[model samples]
Target: MKAAITLESVTIRTELRPGDIGYVIYMHGDIYSKEYGYSLGFESYVAESFVEFYKQYDANLDRVWVCEHNEKIIGFLLLMHRGKAAQLRYFIMEKPYRGIGLGKKLMNLYMNELNSLGYESSYLLTVDELPAAASLYKRHGFRLTEEKPFSDFGKPLMEQKYELMLR
Candidate 1:
């Protein structure tokens, strides 16, 4: 993981079709394991075939973005578009590139895109233990919408939901 903030060698863009689903699934799985201590049970792709996952992701490709570094997929963010409101379902950065601002860049891009799409607000959920993540969301104009105890991977965790009104 490169900890530098340079994205010169990295390319970030929207996922347009099913062809990019495999990379999204693989990167997302690895990132989730590193950040959340468990995979999203995304066992199909990069293990078996990605027929089912591909279909699902493809159906909502407009809400997904892929970041590639050195021609390999590194990270991704998934957004659930709901008319005027958007929910950030997942955001992850793999272990090797933890300290870099890739997470922030992904988030800024997501918010900017959503705003341009006429969204009035966006929401994201994060665990309270991840102070860095929570701070990042706050720095980007997200406020604490709610906080609650939630179980992740069978472990007790305090989850926080944040909202950013785009106006």
Candidate 2:
């Protein structure tokens, strides 16, 4: 049985263990499929991007927050460096962990790291289906700079990009 998700019961880890990324990919595939009807293509996209991120990861320029409860992952967020910019990627929280200030905590960490690293700009790609997440992004000063029809994730939905200029 899962314990109640108070902050004290949760461990926010910044370093990845050997199996962490694989499990994160699996969770993304499983949860997105059940909640939003995403296909294996979405899983593949996540895996591919993660591989790219790993290849170029630098502790000085990148960061990841993995939230765990009782040693099991419950949420994840990643920041990847690109030239002089950064990309906020793979931000997700388990259903039971949403609406309880966890997402905001992760976003605060992301913003602080972005500012500390002095990235000129930052952006994230997300679907319009995620209204709560979109609202969080907006509240953190990201502007919806792009949107268009998209279907690669099994269901047709509008793909959106939010960006922030930090100069």
lDDT of each: 0.67, 0.93
**Local accuracy of candidate 2 as per-residue lDDT tens digits, 1-167:** 95576866778999988998999999999999999889999999999999999999899899999999878999999999998989999998889888778899999999999999999999999999999999999999999999999999888999999999999
Off by over 4 Å in 1: 1-5, 17-19, 34-36, 39-61
Instruction: Name the lDDT value of residue 93 in candidate 2.
Output: 83
Using lDDT as the measure, the top candidate is 2
Candidate 2 least-lDDT 10 residues: 2-11
Q: Residues 3-66, candidate 1: write the lDDT tens digits.
A: 6546665677776455566655566566656766754544332334334333544333236667
In model 2, the runs with Cα more than 4 Å from the true position are 1-3
Residue 111 CA displacement from its true place in model 1, Å: 2.1
Model 2 TM-score, 2 decimals? 0.96
- Candidates' TM-scores? 0.73, 0.96
At residue 43, give the lDDT of candidate 1. Answer: 33
